[model samples]
Target: MALIILAHPNFDKSFANKTIIEALENSKLDLEIRNIHDLYPDFKINAKAEQEALLRHQTIVFQYPFYWYSMPAILKQWFDIVFEYQFAYGSKGDKLKNKNFVPSFTVGSSESSYTALGFQHFRVYEFCKHLEQTAYHTQMNYIDPIYFHGTSLAAGYTPDSIMTNAKHHAQKLIATLSQLQ
Candidate 1:
């Protein structure tokens, strides 16, 4: 089973990420999703609890809206504290060995805009290096990320569009989990 980690800082204010989470909650993906904003509103993460959750699953999917080419702040903090010595890295640390780490995110800009010749001046993979490298360090198989781009000005985007894409993304995420399993 895959554990979908929800890390949107303001999920209530979000149109894309929120719908995606809702879709996963309704699906049968064997998901153990944790909303960072709700779980650690004050940023005090339960280390033991988080680690135990990690132990229970073989795949980890970080679902968040791309912020400044990375994940939301709380997720980065989760990585810093949760993935520590003797637990996620080093000779004794192998909690994530052979596990899959997939990053599924929403980007306001178009995929093309994340290229060298594009506005962002960096490829999506290049921007996601940190996530991939972290997975590598912990011996996790980094999977190709799923991205929803150009949604801000996607034209005709409405509540229906949000729900449709959310369900679609959720199904795709589940498909990826099935492959890993």
Candidate 2:
């Protein structure tokens, strides 16, 4: 099973994230949704409960929007609090070992804009290097990320295009989970 930890500050107003969430909701796979903003509007996180949730799943998916080239404030806080030294690292931190860490996100800019010659000046992988390193430190497998670019202020995109990507997003995630060794 994969646990999707979604953190979107303005979830209600999101078109791309919402579409993907709906697709996941309608899928048949074993999934657990944790909308952090809805769960802890005050930024209060229950570490123990979150740890227990991680222990139950073999895969952990952090789904969110790209905020200032990184994750939202609440999600970053979740990482700081939930992935404790004794639990996610250090000599005794083996609880997360062998698990998979997958990051699913939506980027506002075009995919090409993330290249070296483009505005972002780096690839998506470079942007998410911290996440990959976190997974490595925790002894977990860092799976390929799932991201949909040109999702925000999509000047040239239509509603149908978004929906199509949403449907494909869900399918790809399920496929990735199934292919995991």
> In terms of TM-score, which candidate is strongest?
2
- At residue 49, candidate 2 shows an lDDT of 89
Report the number of clashing residue pairs per model: 0, 0
Write the residue-wise lDDT of candidate 2 on 1-181 in tens digits.
7898999999988777888888878877788999989889999999998999999999988989888899999999999999999999999999999999999888887889999999989988888889889999999999988887777655576667766776777678778877762
The stretch of ten residues in a row with the least summed lDDT in candidate 1 is: 150-159
Stretches of model 2 off by over 4 angstroms after superposition: 154-156
TM-scores, in order shown?
A: 0.91, 0.94
Error of 2 at 13 (Å): 1.4
Superposed by TM-score, candidate 2 places the C-alpha of residue 123 at a distance from the truth, in angstroms, of 1.5
lDDT of each: 0.84, 0.87
> What tens-digit string does per-residue lDDT give for candidate 1 at 65-179?
8888888899999998899999999989998899889999988777778888999999888888888889999999999898777556354456666666766887888778878
Error of 1 at 142 (Å): 1.0
